[model samples]
Target: MRLTQHDATAPTGMRNNYVVMRPQNLSVGVLPVHDDGSVTLVGQQRFGLMNYSWEMPEGGAPYDEDPIDGVKRELAEEAGLAASHWREALKIELSNSITDQRAMAWVAWGLSAMPIAPDPTEIIRVTRVPFGDLMREIARGSVRDMFTVATTLRAYHMAHQGELPPCLAKAMLASVR
Candidate 1:
C-alpha cells in the first residue's frame, strides 16, 4: 500500500493540521504452548501504570522477510525459541494510544523450549503459565496481548471443533494491557 506523505509546508514534528497518515507496520506475534498445556509469554520491555503485561513475543515483519519467516525470526529474537511449525491464529488491527499497525498473530505448537537469546535491542522476559490459567489471566487483566487472548481463545475453540480456518495460522495479533 502507498503511504501518503504531507508537510506540503509544515515544520518538523508538525502535521500542519493536515492528514497525518500513519504508516502501517506489519508485524507478528507468537502464542506458544507446550504438550503439558502450558503457555509461554513475556514481560514487555516497556511498563505501564497497570503493571507490565504478560504477552507473547512479537515483532515487525521486515520488508524483505515473508510473514512466516518474520514470525520465526521474532520468536527466536524475542522469546529465544524456534519452531518447526507455525500457524496463523487471528487477525486484528490495533489502533490506540500506544500503537497503530496491522498485526498477524500466530500459534507455534510442538515447541521445544530452550534458552532465549533475545536481541540486545529488545527488553523481554520469557515466562510460562498453565493453559487453564490463561482465561483467568485475561479475566484479571494480567494477560495484555489482545492478539494473544484472541488467538488462544480461538485455538481452544478450534481444538474442540476439529481443524481450523485455512488462515488459521495467519492472524492479526495485539492487545493493550
Candidate 2:
C-alpha cells in the first residue's frame, strides 16, 4: 500500500491537499457454508490491527484476474475447502475516505475438503461455526473483520430474502433460530 497526495475541492467548495492510500490489488472474501448451515472461518493475528481475528477466508486478486479465481484459492489455502457452488454476496469499498481498497465477497457451498496451503507469513487456525452462532459472535463484537461481517450478514439476508437456494436457506435460517 502507498499514499499519494492530491489536490481536491471539498463539498463546501474548499480546496485542500489530501493524502489517499492506494492498495495494490482488489480483494475478495468468501463465506464457505456447509449443507448443515455451518460456515468456515480462519483465525490469525492481523498485523495492522495487532490483534487475533477470526474472519471468513479472504485474499487479494489482481485487477486483470477474475475475483472468483482468487476466492477459490483463498478458500483452499486458508480453510482447506473447495466449493461446487458460488454466489456473489457483495461488492464494497472499505474505508473509502482513506483507502481505495475494494472487495468482492461470495457465498460458497457444496463444500469438500482440500489440502491447506497458507502463505509463509500466515499462521492460521481454521474453524467451522454454526451460522447462528457466528451471527451471535459478530453482534457481540468477537468477530470484527469488516469483510467477514458484511459477507455473513449478506448471506443471512440472502437466506431470508430468497436469493439463496430454498433448501440451503432453510438450513441456514434454521441454525439461526
Candidate 3:
C-alpha cells in the first residue's frame, strides 16, 4: 500500500490536499450456494477490523491473474467446495473515498467437496447456512462483510429476475419466504 497527497478543489473554490491510499492487487470473493439453497460462509479473525467476521471465501488476486481462478481457489481453500457453474455478481470499489481497492464477486452453485488448503496465515471455519437465514443474519448485522452482503443480495436479485434456473431460483426464493 502507498499513500500520496494531491490537490483537490472544493465546490466553493477552496483548495486542499487530499491524501489517498493506493492498495496493490485486486480482490475476489465467491458465494458458494448448494442445491438446497444453502450457502457456505467462512469465519476468521480479520486483522483490518480487529474482529471475527463471517464472510464469503475471499482473497487477493494479482492484477494479472484472472479473478475467476482466484475465486475458485478461495472457494476450495476456505470452504472445501467446488462449483460447476459460476456467475459474476458484482464489481465493487471498497472504501472508494480512502483507497483504490477493488473487488469482484461471484455466485457459484453445483457444489461438490474438495480438499481444503487454507492459507498458512489463516485459520478458517466454514458453515452452511440456509439462504434466508443468511439474509436475516445480514439484516441483523451479524454478517457485515461487504463482499458477502453484496453478492448474496445480487443472488437474491438474480433469483427474482429469472436469471437463474427455475428450480434453483425457486429453491432459493422459497427459503426467504
Candidate number with greatest lDDT: 2
Clashes of each: 15, 0, 0
User: How large is the C-alpha RMSD of every model relative to the true structure?
Assistant: 7.4, 0.8, 1.2
Candidate 1 C-alpha RMSD relative to the actual structure = 7.4
Q: All candidates' TM-scores?
A: 0.71, 0.97, 0.95
Q: Between 2 and 3, whose TM-score is larger?
A: 2
Which residue segments of model 2 deviate by more than 4 Å?
A: none
How many angstroms is residue 89 displaced in model 1 relative to the true structure, after the best TM-score fit? 0.8
Q: lDDT of each prediction vs. the true structure?
A: 0.66, 0.94, 0.90
Off by over 4 Å in 3: none
Weakest lDDT window of 10 consecutive positions for candidate 2: 168-177
Better of 1 and 2 by TM-score: 2
lDDT of 1 by residue, 1-177 (tens): 343444555556555533433444476888776655566787764543545667777777855667888888777777777766666777777764334567788777667656777777656877777766776788788776777788778776655464433332222111111
> Pairing residues by index, what is the TM-score of model 1?
0.71
Better of 1 and 2 by lDDT: 2
Q: Which is better, 1 or 3, measured by lDDT?
A: 3
> lDDT tens string, model 2, 1-108?
899999999999999999899888898989999999889999999999799999999999988888899889999999999999999999999999888999999999
